[model samples]
Target: MLYSDKAPDPVGLYPHARRVGNLLFLSGVGPRKKGSKDIPGVTLDNHGNIIAYDIEQQCHAVFENVRFILEASGARWENLVDVTVYLTNMKADFATFNKIYATYFKENQPCRTTVEVNALPTPIAIELKCIAAFEDK
Candidate 1:
């Protein structure tokens, strides 16, 4: 079986959830509003936005955006088994990353790796991509 979801006015990416058999592959989600983009932050609504450039806040926002994807798929963070994080500067943000990560997955603790890169599309600090699964029977 296959599944998908699309929410207008809140995001540009639609069909956010994709299911292949028992596994669900989610796109890299970032915090953004319906008309605008996910620049960074918690205050982003229909019009206003908040810019969260700090590593801690940036990482948290990414995960919070991810949470929406997970929920759309009828799953939760705990359903995640593996994750890949891309960072523009790993050394400067390691501690902050671990701290915010714990708040989201302290118990589930998905297999993950943090890697440093040249940069992302935005000036924001980090981006996260994940894979989640469940029994398909």
Candidate 2:
């Protein structure tokens, strides 16, 4: 009964499903809207904006967004086994990023890796991609 149900990723090119016995590997999700959200404030001209945003706020949203995707797929943050974070300004803002991230997976710490990048789909300051695992029941 292992199978992928939904994907949060905008580009549908990637398969959102993978199965191995009782395990499923869902694709990573970001904060970009499938279409658009009219997110307002001080957003990038080409994308949505946050008026009072810092690495902390953005990190929270990114994790929450991934949690939503996992829930839709019948999984939870506790099911996450690995998380990969991408940041445009990692060296400068990562301290706050890790702080916020700690709150989400406080109970279950998964293997994690963060990389610094030059840009992301949106100018939201931070982007997170994760892999979740749930026991088949």
Candidate 3:
């Protein structure tokens, strides 16, 4: 099944998440707000050059978006089995991201992989791709 709702709409034609059997696979979720092009923490100049940003804010938004998707799919933070994090600047943001991440995942830590990349499709700092498993019927 496909899940999409008031959460940030997918930038592409894909659904926010898809469930195969018990596992729900979420598409890359960014910090962009739903029904708007604005991305949290993104500050642009008149010419669209990034003047400033807050990684912490972006991280929170991304996780909120991920949470919405997970819940919409009948899953929760505890149901997540794995997560893949994409960061535009790992060296600069990893420490901050890790701190915030720990708060959310807490003792229910799932397998995770974080990687640095040149950029995402949008001007956000972080995106999350997650997999969650629902209880078997």
Candidate 4:
């Protein structure tokens, strides 16, 4: 099991990542900063409903959180093999997300799947689940 002090706390009771054999499986990572409930680029109303969000900002933050978990699990960014992205508003966010994603994944192109969802566990707009592989040295 792996936990990262630099990554945001998971909404559920789960570690950041778990390593088995040569693979590390990361839990869903969001844009919230470590030890903070305020999600990046998200503006919520008084009732805690999302009023506005910046997909680009959320994308960068979630990627950084994923990096933190991968480092905690003894993996490298280049070792990422797969990524699953969940977006609350695909129609509004997909293009922006793809643009930001390409900038980070220019060299290490992992297999990816993106889907639209109604919402996440938090007010965040984006989340990522990842898998990485490394030699069992």
The lDDT leader among the candidates is 4
List the global CA lDDT of all models: 0.66, 0.63, 0.88, 0.91
- lDDT tens readout by residue for model 1, 13-126: 445667777687776554443345545543434544323356666676677667777777888888898888888778888888888788888789888988888866545567
TM, every model: 0.74, 0.73, 0.94, 0.97
Candidate 4, 74-118: lDDT as tens digits? 789999999999999999899999999999999999999999999
> In candidate 1, which residue ranges exceed 4 Å CA deviation?
1-15, 41-52
Model 4 misplacement above 4 A:
none
Q: How big is the positional error of residue 120 in model 2, measured in Å on the Cα after superposition? A: 1.8
Give per-residue CA lDDT, model 3, range 1-137, as digits (tens).
56657588777889999988888999999988888877889998877767889999998898888888888887888999999999999999999999999999887889999999998987888999999999887
Relative to the unseen true structure, what is the Cα RMSD of model 3?
1.2
Model 4 per-residue lDDT at 116 = 93
lDDT of 2 at 94: 87
Models sorted by lDDT, best on top: 4, 3, 1, 2
What is the Cα-based TM-score of model 3?
0.94
Question: How many collisions between residues are there in candidate 3?
Answer: 0
